[model samples]
Structures are given as C-alpha cells and as structure tokens.
Target: MPLIVFCGIPGSGKTTRALQIKEYLEQKHKCQVVHLNEEILQMEKKEVYKDFQAEKFARGFLRSNVEKNIAGNTVVILDSLNYIKGYRYELFCLARAAQTQHCVIYCECDPQLAKENNSKNANNFTEEMLADYNNRLEIPIPKNRWDSPLFHLRSKEETPFEEIANVLLYQAKKSKDPVSTAPEIKFEINFLQELDLRVQSVIDELVQKQQESIQSNVITFSDCTEKLMINKQISLIELKKIKQEYLKITKHNPPKRIEDIKNFFIIYLQKVVERF
Candidate 1:
C-alpha cells in the first residue's frame, strides 16, 4: 500500500490530479484506491478551518481515518490543502508506522489563476481566506525526509503519473511480506498491580483536592522528579474520563520499564490537565 497526498491552494487542481492518479492506479495496476477528500467526508470548510482548534480536530480526524483504512491492497489518496509542513510530517510518520510508502503531489498554480478558478466553481474559499492560506503555505522541500518523493503539477496535464505510479507500485507488487508491526509487549503482573495502585492513588488525591475547593495545586507522583499541576477546577467525571484515556494510550504503547510508568503517567496528567 502507498499514500498519495495532494496538497495545494484552492483551485490548484489538487482534486483533479488526485482523481487522475486514482484512475491510472486502478486501471493500470488494479489498485484499490481510497480517495480522501474534505468534500467526500461532508466537512464544512467554514467550520473545519475556522480556527486553530477546529483545524487541529479536522486534521486529527483525517489522520485517524488514514490509519484505520491503510491496509490490504489499498492505495490511499488524501486530497486537501495540506499547506502545513508540521501536519505533513505527521502524515509521513503515520505512513511509516503502517509499513507503507507515501508521496506528495503539489499542485502549483498562479494565485490569480487559482482565485479565478475557485470563483468560477462557486467554492467556499473566499479571496481573503485564499490569500491567507497562500501566505501561510509552507511549500514542500525535497531535502526534508518527509517531503521527499514529491511531485509537482502546475496543471492537470503536468501530473507525473508514470513516475508516481512506478514508485508506489514497484515495492508493493514485489514484496509478498505482510505489513510490519511492533512485537507485542507484555507487562509483568507485579508491574500491572503497581500501575493500578498508583493510578487510583492519583485519582483519589485529585478528587480530595477538588472536594476541598482547591483551585490550583501541585501534586507529586511517586518516584518522579516532575509534578502534576492542576490550575482549573476539574470534576470527578472529567478525571475519570482522563483516566480511561490514559489507560487506553498506555495499553497500546506501554512504558518499556516499570520504573518509567510513574513518570509517564505524570507527564500524561500534566498534558491533559493543562487543557482544563
């Protein structure tokens, strides 16, 4: 499997190039393509790209979708204005973790041309929004590891279809090996017991502090130099919810050593509590 990401400003023909590649892959290589587009997912542009938090949520949702679907004879195509380098890096990491190769197809076009095209289509992107996006755009650099294997398409006709298809298909068809995954890690019974005990102790301490009407306090986790800081009033329900999330995260990728468990949990608490 391979992930082909299309990134550009509105009206740069990202969707067109994505669909072109999708057709070529399907017809030539018999590849099953997963075309991911904001329109396809029924997301409102004004809502999703409204603010930092909204964009972050949208990106997280798209990343989760890629992670969930990138398996078994599928060629994933993410079509969007992926103008942020940091977000592109996250996608690269996700592809690596899934044991698949990925590439970016940047659709380069004149700002005026893009604006005209968008207006002709009656797209949601306003002139101000498009200009802001252009100003904020971090063009892909081939020197960066994540941005390597990048292709440029100034127009639909300029798409590097053959080269892209070759890169994505060669290893996929050549290798019969299954997707590589990290070996399952087993936590010892003693370590598990301690984990539960310490987690409960943390919850009780925080709940007691809340009951006592403490607005802010620093709580120490055992055997760690770092401390947990609670700056806002948190309810028991919220605390329990955070606990469940912590458990879920730890379950997937547990601390390598039992000694590190307390530190890990404390760090996790600091992050989750800071939002409250």
Candidate 2:
C-alpha cells in the first residue's frame, strides 16, 4: 500500500495538492488512487464527520480502505484535514498493519492566504469552522519511528506540486514490485446472495431519488455502499441492519432489471469469495 496523508489547517491547499498528486500518479505511473473524503461523504448519505467523534469514525473507515488497497498495486491518497495528532498516529498504525509504505505531505500555506482562498471557493468552510480547527489543531512533528518520510511544503512562495509529484513518482518507481499473481475465481451462490441483498437494500433507499454519477460505472450510492462494505469491515448483522432500513423505508424491495448490475454482482461475489 502506498498511503500519503496530508496534514494542515483548514484551506491549506491539502485537497488541491492531493488531487494533483493523484493525477500525477495515475497518468505517469498508471496507478489508481482511492480518495477517502469524497468516497465517504457520498457513501454514508450523511456527513458522518462533522465533529470530532465523527472524525474518529472517518479515521476507522480510512484504516480499512488502506488495508484493502494494500492487496493491489495502486497508491491510495488520503486527502483530509489531518490536524489532530492522535488521528495521525492512527493512520500510522493502519499503514503498519497493511505493511504498506506511507508518507506525510504537510500542505503548509500562509494562514491569511488560505482563509482568502477558502472565502472565494464554493464549498469552502465558513469562519466558524476555520476558527475551531485552527484553535485546536496540533501540528505534526517529523519523526522516524513511524518509518514513513514526511515532506513539509510551505505553499504560497513554493507550491510544491511539481516537486512533490516528482518525489512521489520516484518513490513509486523505486518501490515497484512484481504485479500480484493471485488466481481469479468466479463468485459462488452464497457470496452473490449476500451482495444481492446489500445492493437491493441500497437500491430500495435510492429508488425515489435521482442520483448522479461522480465517475463512470461509479454512482454516489454505489460508492457509499461499496465503502460501507469495503471500509467499515461491516459484519453480517450490520448488513442485515441496512436491509432492515430498506425494508422500513420502502416496505418492499426495489425491482431489479439491468443485466449489467446482475452480472456485476455475480462476478463481484465470485471474486470476493475466491480472495477469501
């Protein structure tokens, strides 16, 4: 796993830089990046991390995602305001558990400039959020015990996008290992049954609403539901709870028609069960 955690205050250009790094990794190295914040918000159907408690849930979600991506060769970039020290430590533990290489890219920018930029952006946080985050945020200090290299970037004068991108590309090249040779298998009956139930539950909830696709073959509800399945490490009971919610909301299952989704679930379950 290749995990890059960004640490900075609100509006410190963390997201911007993370996206840039993601693009660079994808285009140059042919690596796929799983972004945490965008994936989680759309998946949960609600903002689960508005406060500190929610943040912990989000961190737990990230840990699982990093672990999942470790099996693949792609680099996962965690783009968020990792301002809390404890949260940073939790991320370190996650990387270690996954046995993946990790790095920290500190998006250092002038506070006033970040505030100005945030004020001008559409989804930017308001004054209250900036104040709360700034006041309570504990900055990270570089260390070696974590076994990951940390790069501190002071933005305004030196927006380290290109330089950092180069560094990340170099790291990716040096760390290249042979591609995974695991055998592929078809999904079994039991596995598809479970996935079918879960998808049916989500479709039941999303039936009435018009949802838009954020990426190809990847709708918002799909992303969210997949995250719940992939990241939360949810148990069978929790999945049953989702189905219960669907039953409570719709009082019936949503009719399934598309051959593609049907085929996907069938194949998806096969792959998952085989991996197990």
The lowest-lDDT stretch of 10 consecutive residues in candidate 1 is 173-182
For candidate 2, write residues 1-276 as lDDT tens digits: 567888787678887787777787778667777766644544341254466456556656665676677557677777777775545655665564444567787777677888997787666666777777787776666743332477888775454555555545566556544447423334444544555565674544433222332223222354342211232132455435544543332222122332233333322322232223
- For each candidate, what is the lDDT? 0.75, 0.56
The reply for model 2, stretches above 4 Å from the true place, is 38-40, 43-49, 157-276
Evaluated at residue 257, the lDDT of candidate 1 is 66
RMSD of each: 8.1, 15.9
What is the TM-score of each predicted model, taking all chains together?
0.64, 0.54
What is candidate 1's CA lDDT for residue 58?
76
Give one digit per residue, the lDDT tens place, for model 1 in 22-77: 89888987889999977888888767887766876777777778877886579999
